[model samples]
Target: MATTLFFLLFFTPFLYSAAAPNHNAPQDLVRSSCINASYPSLCLRTLSSYSGPTGTPRDLAQAAVKVGLARARKASTYLKTSVTGKSERERAALSDCVEQMAESVDELSKTLSELKHLRGETFEFQMSNARTWVSAALTYEDTCVDGFEGVDRKVKGDVKKKITNVAMVTSNALYMIRRLDESGGLNR
Candidate 1:
């Protein structure tokens, strides 16, 4: 009976200790720790840093826009080349990305123009537009990302470029939405 009690006490602690380490396992220990320590705010801050600004939502949006423009330009070139002679799926993806890019540019331009005349009540419309634009951009990005999945690494430069362009346009749209959100324009 004493041996049983001894084993229970000794083995239980060892078992617990072993399990504890698993929680701190190498796979995602660092990420988990950081997330636990900071959470949503920290996540936002980290994302903002990608644009070289403080944790403000506007900065995050701006960063996304800059990245999108650069990516879209590159992708546009590739898309132009790949669309010429490609499979139906490839052609469809390229076309979709291009369309999304055009939409993003149009939305962004309109938002910027609206911002010049923005009043308190008008902010709501601006916010709504921003959200819609961002959502569309994200959708386009998803399509492009999915299209590239399982594609041969040796895919032509043009194909890769189209994918990149779509990604950039989407990214920029997201940034614009973030900016609107941060500006307190969408709070209502």
Candidate 2:
């Protein structure tokens, strides 16, 4: 019984360690230290520089556009460098980015339509053109990702940027479009 207890105590820890899921494994302390050492104050700077509104009416439309553009850009880069069979994570991330871009474009369209109604004649043509451009970009992005691992897939990158840019330009097409709406400038 003494020998059995000793063996149980000694082997239990090893058995549990082996059974643990790999995903739950703790990150390497040394690697984290190295990253912090190399990056220094970069993370702090980013956190401090965040421009998201803190007290104002958070413009969901504008935020969506910005996030969409950023995600599209990231997806573009990922697609450029990703290799087959090793891009599961990258592919998933790209999909998420594309989805965000699409959602932002939709939001921007709705906002533009509202602004058009508010601005009337001043934004009529410009808003119409902007909608057309956004629709085209969305369609392009939606169709870009086709054929994945021998199956049909639709992947798009930076589409949000294109749509946002067009919407922004349209938003600025007439002086009234910018002035009538309180969403700030396209440059923002």
Candidate 3:
């Protein structure tokens, strides 16, 4: 009985370890990390699709900014190519929205760059900059949608839908950055 007990004790750990989920797996790390995001499911979707490291808050924040940047770029391209306003006002709004999307892309790129090099004594300052840039990116996205307010219903709907998706993603990125700041992950 003692031998059997010892064998169980020794093997049990191995069995459990083998069966347990890998917390360090990139997807799992992103999933847990995105739980506090404003749009958790969207955060999961965007960050999971990114083929990058996500082992730390900084890594996750960087990945998120990358995703947001890509989405903003796509939206900007789509606005430039696919959208056309039937009326002059609609055209103006579309123009303004396209510009805002471009600005969002630029801000997200800056945020990703900042997040990538966060270290040393400037870790907190770098994180703050990243958060601010991401926040600006989200703001640009929101402004893009706001420009569509007086547009034709169909145009407004279509533009709002597209910009709103980008905004949500950017907002999630901002949330991730904020969570990183609050986590004090930079200190470690």
**In model 1, what are the clashing residue pairs, if there are any?**
61-175, 68-168, 75-161
lDDT of 3 by residue, 120-156 (tens): 7887898878878888888888888888776789888
Write down the lDDT that model 2 would get.
0.40
Least well predicted 10-residue stretch by lDDT in candidate 2 = 25-34
What residue runs in model 3 are displaced by over 4 Å at the alpha carbon?
1-24, 83-85
After superposition, candidate 2 runs with Cα above 4 Å error: 1-50, 53-59, 83-121, 149-188
- Per-model TM against the reference: 0.47, 0.33, 0.84
User: Which is the leading candidate under lDDT?
Assistant: 3
Better of 1 and 2 by TM-score: 1
Q: Model-by-model lDDT, in order? A: 0.52, 0.40, 0.82
TM-score winner between 1 and 3, please give it.
Answer: 3
Off by over 4 Å in 1: 1-63, 84-93, 112-117, 147-153, 156-176, 179-188
**Candidate with more favorable, higher lDDT: 1 or 2:** 1
RMSD of each: 12.3, 19.8, 3.2
State the weakest 10-residue window (summed lDDT) of model 3.
Answer: 78-87
- Candidate maximizing TM-score: 3
